[model samples]
Target: MKITDMTSECIGKCLNYLSFDDLLRAAISNKKLNNAANLIYEQKYRSKRVEMHILSRLHSNYFMTENRFCFYSLRTSFQFLFCFGRQVNEIHISYIPRYVIPGENGVQNENNVELTHRAIDYANDYCAESLRTIKFTRIQDASRYMKRPFINLENLEFYDCNFTDLVEYNLLNALFPKVQKLVLKTINKNLDQPCTLKFIEGRFAHLKSLHIESNSYSKFHHADEYCILKGNLVTAFRLNPQLKELDLDLFVNCHVFQSNDVLLVINYLQNLDSLSLAIDDTFCSLLDSSVPPLMYFRNLKKFSLNMQLSTESRAIQFTSHQLDTFELHGVDRFTNYEYEFLEKHPTITKLILRGGHFERLNLSRIAAALPILEQLMIFDHFKLKIEEIVPHWSKFQSLKLLCFFHTKIVKDSDLKPLLINGWHGRFCNSPNKFQIILKR
Candidate 1:
């Protein structure tokens, strides 16, 4: 079929794979392509993309030779807003630089604030019913722009807020209480001031996934004063205990003085399907306990442990039907325990070890231990070897991806078992066997 005769729907689906600039270029020259690109952009309106869209307006230096009727290239944005604004799924407000009038040179502060507020007004008037996500990136003051919250907003994200004044959850909740997926990253707060919001039974009625973190690991913000993880989490936990996918590791310390606190938080959410947390001190108190508390996560199918310190436990062991995906990140000294634990969990389909104990991480043993293991990823420093289990190379019956990233291999010859007898990395003797990946 000729490209011109193709339906706009098909052309729009094709645009999904292309980058933004490419998509616009592909759409502008062709009539069908233009319609298709416009239709697709309505659905994929992520805030990051919105921010770029704003900048593209200001710094779009090259003179345009394409069709002026095109949605993005229209003479003025009002043409697109009047026609398609209501269909867009997200509203983006990223502290945009206001328009420079025909005669103006530099930015006018009063004009910019009015312009920013006008965009918010446009969102509140047109996209109120459809807008489900609103993202604020490095927004210092939202008072001028945040005139009203979209009642239907389901996701809200605040990124790089550590560089600006922190927005209290109470005020944010009042704005987006029904948000299901909320991400608060790198938020700088004053711990000395007392919180004014009274306890509410369930402030977040629709919350399902919550990611609250302190500053990103750039400077570590090293001082305790900058840490948000040390605060009282009792109110937030009690209010949103039903969250299914929880990642609080952002700043909560799970080390020397805060180990019990971490365990207590986990114990409260026994029904979580996935949990990701960070550890500061050690893994001994929890992993070395007579009864590892992590095992008690009966409903937890996926667990990611980000260890800031070394994993000092001797051996790890757990046998559960529900527990499958396990990821351990950090410098680990306990390979014997990982081996023991892997052998016990046949249900584990995805395993990621960011920190592996050298020499003891036997690929042959892992192939033998995990029967249904589909994806295996290793990162950082690691030494892997394949020993007696080489003879049973076909043991990797259901294996798929075995990846090694940034891992230093001590003995290269130990990998010979994978090549011998045309084994092809000692994979399953099937057409759909796993691939052994070696990455720097």
Candidate 2:
């Protein structure tokens, strides 16, 4: 029905599916509909207090109030409590100028001291008592704001802010006091040109999940070097005892510590059930042959490692008897040592192998080792002697998804039964169909 014919019941149902903005637009065309929709939107989607600031107003009299609805500052802080309006549950502030690097186009970049204070005030006033998740940004010096620790925030994220310098220690120390999930991005590994493990022990003690990514690969490498010398990486694993998931990718050339050093750091992270480790040649070589004593991650389910495997040495040696889902990259040369390693534990059900020459691979040996293997992915061209083990393929009857890329033997005639029953994935030789053949 048209707007005139529609009743309040019809409008309420319609607005339920429309976003606040869309509903507002629809209401503007009809006063009765607008009045009814406004009430519902405010009751459901609208926050009791909404605050937005483009600049700090810390010096202004507006912030002096003991309790207020919304407080925002581009200079200082809007000091207000949430009691005035349910404790300002959501606060969003952006500092885009800090992103403009100092020397870029000769822009003289200086610290926005006033703005920094304003940000800390918002976090303290809005998030200290009742806020659920507060996202803070444009923090040139997160350290100063994070010092007092009045926050009970559950989720915290920092963009283009450095949190590792001694100057910022108080800031990190303050932020993670009660935060459950913490994320950092596009920030300096070295706050002031020197590498620092800014949050190893002081911050994130209560963190359950941690995710860090560098905007530039080179900068991340710079951070890795700092972590190694200061033992920051090791200390991080030890500090977050309650941490359950970790995703870290270092960009710079990492310093290769002894295997014991690596184990010393990882063993402390026994609580980690989902782990993703992405290292380059320098770091992977360190873990080549040495296997860290598996700390009991009884709940461990998914484990992935993306690092270069040195032909001279195995890139990583994982000996977890509990690991179920496994993905490895840069592991080819199927040496006897690598083969024996897998033979010892064949319980893994899913496997993904990337970037390796399998010319030396023994199909029979692999099938014997992992009799229960179900899903396999090989993403690289390798010389495979499939003819040798065609008859023994019965062992792989349990296989479900098999993928081959750029292999020498695409359609081996002897492998007919396995192809029809299992889902065969391969590159199509023509646009019409995938180039896969079965044995007669």
Best model number under TM-score: 1
TM value for model 1:
0.63
lDDT of 2 at 234: 61
- Candidate 1 colliding pairs: 255-281, 315-337, 316-337
Off by over 4 Å in 2: 1-139, 142-160, 164-167, 171-173, 185-195, 203-206, 212-229, 256-258, 279-300, 309-311, 357-361, 380-393, 406-419, 422-440
Clashes of each: 3, 14
**Residue-by-residue lDDT tens digits, candidate 2, 118-193:** 5566566545666656665655555455444546667777665654455634436455478878776656544443
lDDT for residue 203 in candidate 2, whole number 0-100? 44
lDDT of 1 by residue, 1-440 (tens): 87667776677667789875576566566667767776676565422123211333343322322221212222233333434455656544654444453344664322234444455556566666667877765454443345566678898776653322243433556666578888766554432222211212235878888776653333433444333423335456666778788776544342212455555565567667887876554434555567655446668798887667533644433234687899987745655666787777778899988764444456667877888887777655653335433555566777665665322232445566555443334322223222245311
